[model samples]
Target: MTGSVWLVGAGPGDPELLTLKARRLLDEADVVVHDRLGCASVVQELPPTTRLIDVGKSPHHHPVPQDEINQILVRGARAGHRVVRLKGGDPFVLGRGGEELRSCREAGVACEVVPGVSSAISAPASAGIPVTHRGLSTGFLVLSGHEEVDVDQLAATAFTIVILMGMYRLPTLAPALVAAGKDPLTPCAVIQEAWSDRQREVRAPLSQIAVESARAGLANPAVIVIGDVAEGV
Candidate 1:
């Protein structure tokens, strides 16, 4: 009676951005395991017959650990329930979808992945900034805001840099980039609560982004874009 698992990306915080395939899977799944950041709107529209489970994790507060989440999917599938692991943005893009996919496969369950639009690109777009442009930037790099990164390596590249979950790190990130030779006046924009009703944008130069964001008191569920293309209005 083994069932299957689908690692579906809910697409940023906008249910409207959800792909048709993702929507179909959600409609058909017997159980949906959703996260806090992404699936709030989508889950609200789920049919009552479909069971829901919250595995949402926030900055240091994880009620359901990774190991536990893995077991939840495996167990649900083993019970012959079609388990859907719904995450915000693309599951592969910093969503830890790979780990969950591996867990399902290792446990002898079927698994499939459905990609979603990541805020890395959409967030900047929401702020009218493109991560890549003809002359401004030809490429972009997406990095985790929670992890330690090499400032020198980042400074050496001209590619646009996109940082997620980095609101609190803004105070140090901006200065480090400046010291590493990245232009102090590199155009930067932070999209807060992107795609939602409360969405807001903070535009500043690399050296002043920290102070600017602090003054605005911006919070997480944010995406930061740093590059010439981010000449935000």
Candidate 2:
């Protein structure tokens, strides 16, 4: 009797944000693999006999490699233990979930994906900022803050830009947007801990966003929005 793997999104930092399906899976999982970003509290809902594994990523902190996680999932499923592979935000959105799904497929393990609220949109909404408005913004562009991506293209092409894990790259962002022909005074805002009671919002323009973020001490699990869509709030 081979077991199955469930890739569950734990939602942006709030345990209460978990989907009903995710909650049901946690309650029944025989083995649970989770990341640091997702609320660990969800494990509390699991049966005491359930096995828990943490595979979190940090700037310099020690963390389990991805391949190891894949192996763990394969091993547990082969052992006939129902496995729940949990992650932060939506599993398909930059969560490296595709890799895990491929691993399960190759290893002959049945797997399913459960969607969760993404911080990309939730974080912005938490700050009372909308990514789109009737005429302010038609849509939004989502980007990774850690990659060495071309900020110019993002600034020029994206009406409302949402940057995940981008606080560290703020110093170079403004100049890049200016070079991309985006207004230096374009309204922007950064929201932290979306859907959580501790959430905070900082509003500024491209010209001063970096400076304001520094002053406000805004950090990770945060989202940055650029354009007039963020200003109407």
The numbered model that scores best in TM-score is 1
lDDT of 2 by residue, 1-233 (tens): 89999999988877788899998998899999988775566676678898999888865564788899999999999999999999888898878899999999999999999998888877887777888888788888888887887766776775788888888887798778888888898998888767777777888888999899889888876888888877756
Which candidate leads in lDDT?
1
lDDT of 1 by residue, 71-175 (tens): 999999999999899999999999999999999999999999999999898889887888898878999999999899999999889899999999888898889
Q: After superposition, how far is residue 106 of candidate 1 from its true place, in Å?
A: 0.7
Q: List the residue pairs that clash in candidate 2.
A: none
Residue 97 in candidate 1 has what lDDT? 93
Native-referenced Cα lDDT, model 1: 0.92
